[model samples]
Target: MDEEDSQIQKTQLAMTVPTTRVDVLVIGAGQAGLATGYRLAQEGVSFLIVDENQQIGDSWRKRYDSLTLFTPRSLNALPGKVLDGDPDGYPSRDEFADYLANYALHYNLPVQTNFRIASLDIEAEALFWAEGADGSAILARAVVVATGGFQVPVIPEIAGTFSPQVRQLTPETYKGPADVEHGPVVVVGDGASGRDIAFELSAFKSVILSRGRNRRLLPEKLFGISMWKWLKVLGLLRAGPNSPLGRAMRKSDPFPSRERSDRDLEKRGVVLASRLIGANGKRAVFADGSTLDVGAVIWCVGYHDDFTWLMIKAAKDQTGSIVVKDGRSPVPGLFFIGRPWQRNRASALVTGSTADAQRLVDDVEQYLSSTRQGEGSIALVAK
Candidate 1:
């Protein structure tokens, strides 16, 4: 938090004008967006990354301060640089943001902070165009949709109601216990975020609402090798959502267990209640036939995908990810990178995304070469 660093954060925070275009346009400047842009720069591709937020890593920065990534530092790096500070330690929320900003500056990635993409429309000639924040637009011969999966929060619809005095917020907006006004807090959702938040607020009085047992937390390592290493060996990491690993995870009725344990939550007296039935004023009813009075409720239920802003109609499954027919898209010149299992088990990981980016460069090179050939043919016809 030096003076210079502080100033840089401030400059990026200002949400000014928001419109422009470039040869290639990337939406969302999180880990995926920045990684894609950095790789594109190396291949001499004239591209720009635009984010709705005012700065890089805004998504990660907005999370609760106590948050540290589940994965270690070595697994959380981008192309060309490793995360600073502790190479093996899980970075703090802000440290991760700093790492992202540095990654952008290090490579001089052409990222336009605060340039929120309003809508992407296709003009004539099959050009992919995106309308920027102001009203201007960028048209590219190709587009990479790296919006990622963690933008929206999914709040469940429960019965009953709480009084106005009860405070409720999602983990997306939960800063810390200090952010709460006062009193005991009841957190819902047994996912990682739920467990973490419950642990954080336990000292101030807290309870965790477990909807149903899904995944139990396991350490990253079993013996000497990391669990990810074992997963890689078993080919579980490379398995697509249609693969056996993916099918088992998707079909598991309760939920897939977590990779890490919630011992902190359990030790802090965080009650593991069943699904919430309803709320009556200050009392919350649980499926276990129990009731408790809570001063606050925090939901950590995860997110959904919304690609309404993307105008191109490509072949997408129910999840909105472009279906890869042998690592190629139905739309020629349109490519996808940093997607889950786009390549190997590492495709979605930060380090793995770079590998995906390199693969994307191959597609980019072919597309540009084809574009030049098309233009030459048109010139010959005019002659």
Candidate 2:
């Protein structure tokens, strides 16, 4: 090889070295984790962000190639950087990843790629440990679990007698229409992913599925007002559970536009079914007392929150969500951002986490200062 080409390869090898320890540790290098890192960097605090992916943007890049954000580009951006594409259009999956990578580089955030956090343990002090691709263990102080809701895919257990001829796949494992074997496809679940997948696949084959009958779809805009604008104006999106709008939102699915209408799917030759009861080879039973034969089944059922690796017993509820009251958790030094109804309507959105991150930053400063002053010390410890 030429000398210049050999030197370039050597420089690439120099960048992959890993290190341990930081003042703060953020896990899951997706939107939330990266945002937290950016804010911490701005504050000049020593911190490190890590992810399980071998390369940056692996999370977004692994999704189906045709996937696009439901939210407009204007609403989806990392801290300090706006998406470079059309502001009016929903960005493709790759474009979103490009934005994130740019955000990390612009801030010069110290992110250790390919490092996967294995577990967190807290005794008198918090201990964070992770396993890297090279089989090295890295440790840190404060830990922010930004793993988000998409890690685990939940597939329901249905009684069955299958001939082993029918194939099944989850949205996580789905790559494209080319991945499925030839024949009719049955997609289970009526959530956003299910509908989008079914719609995309309907063009190629006759599809069938089940759904909630009374589900409502909210237009991104009503009249000339963006739905986001209305949510903010009507005070519906950010209202607390005690507030009328917040109460209504909590009871309603946020992305109602995702589910296809019965007539809409029927126009595409997709059959809407009630439920899956049991299976017999290619034939399946439904809750409405129906049977059908299909070549493939795609289960798009929602996920369950699993925090078994985290030792924060007091912070989580039975469902593994951090219980918040007035934007504060029960555990000290523990704050949750990007969770449903954590603060305002934007709590769960990519852009909305900035507010939550700022609040948590302020809280962290106050906590450290108070501890240094010996005011927050337990009375029993004095003995």
Candidate 3:
């Protein structure tokens, strides 16, 4: 049989299985999903958390190998779990991933991995049918979309102009310096990922960091205390995106530490390049009319919010981002957690998921209560 026909047969075979029904389905088994699940457990709510990966916390594992969060172990944690070891010390990618797995095991949250929510739609009142990639489906009453941000990587279309000799990669694919090609490397976008990647690569390769937005860099420490402590004390991280402080934060970037400053980057031999404008062959064209030929290009251009799998159009705005106000969507049974600026600047960070989760769980319970009142069906979270 042809490949297409074989795939069709497989999907048909998958559809033969009965759809599992639940009161709440929290999508994405990463830190966000686990945190939300913990809250549901506290409320004794019937819920299930599902992820596309074979294991929980695989999302963090997918990042570059040398990655270490600026947020310390103590600050970034789920509702009930404490990331062990020194509270002030940063946790490496692997360490955090293991913690997530252990958190699920400790709490025994109802988590099902490798269950990809391919698409979702609401047919009956308050009901969501989340179809799996395998053609299987789940029925739920209320959905907590704790998938977190960073859904789809953003690569400029101009990258196609580069010749085959130049290797291109994204954060999802590039693991370490070994993944990069020989010769100079041009890292695009100046976000946290781009900055870290450039700094790490500078030790081994000639790296040029393509600067983007000019973010305000805060000192790692204020007085003798850590900057994180100050943010939490003054409620800076907790500020909403629409709040006066949140609006100010949106205009400015809170750099983790001063060591990552441009001066330090220059000291470490990381060339600060202008905005990336175009590319052809091995030439990386910059906005400053300067160009460089590099062996490989790492696009750290952040991500676009992808709700394509979520077939609903009621809440999504023109930019495809869900129209969420304080983590609750306009859709009755749909809610979100782990959204950047959902409540404030902290909402996107691993440290921030629990805050959103608490509110979202309460929203879910309220939604389900209404469903019960109306004898309505359940909804599903499409990650």
Per-residue CA lDDT of model 2 for 1-383, tens digit only, reads: 85467445434533454436555667778887888887877776667778888767888888877888777777787768888776757788888888788788888888778776554544234433333556444444455667665667776676246446777878778888987775678788877678888888999877887664345667657885566556656766556655777666666666536336556777777888887868888887788888888888888877666666665567778877656664455766555555656676567667566767777666655654554454332211100
| Candidate 3, superposed: residue stretches over 4 Å from native | 1-16, 318-320, 374-383
* Tens-digit lDDT string for candidate 1 (149-189): 56688766652378778888887888988877756677777
- Is candidate 1 or 2 superior in TM-score? 2
Ranking by TM-score: 3, 2, 1
RMSD (Cα, Å) for all candidates, in order, is 9.2, 9.8, 4.9
Estimate candidate 1's RMSD in Å: 9.2
Model 3 TM-score (2 dp): 0.91
> Residue 284 lDDT in model 3?
89
Better of 1 and 3 by lDDT: 3
Off by over 4 Å in 1: 1-21, 224-226, 229-235, 249-263, 313-330, 339-347, 374-383
Model-by-model lDDT, in order?
0.68, 0.68, 0.83
What clash count goes with each model? 12, 0, 4
Worst 10 residues of 2 by lDDT: 374-383
Reference-based lDDT, residue 28, model 3: 89
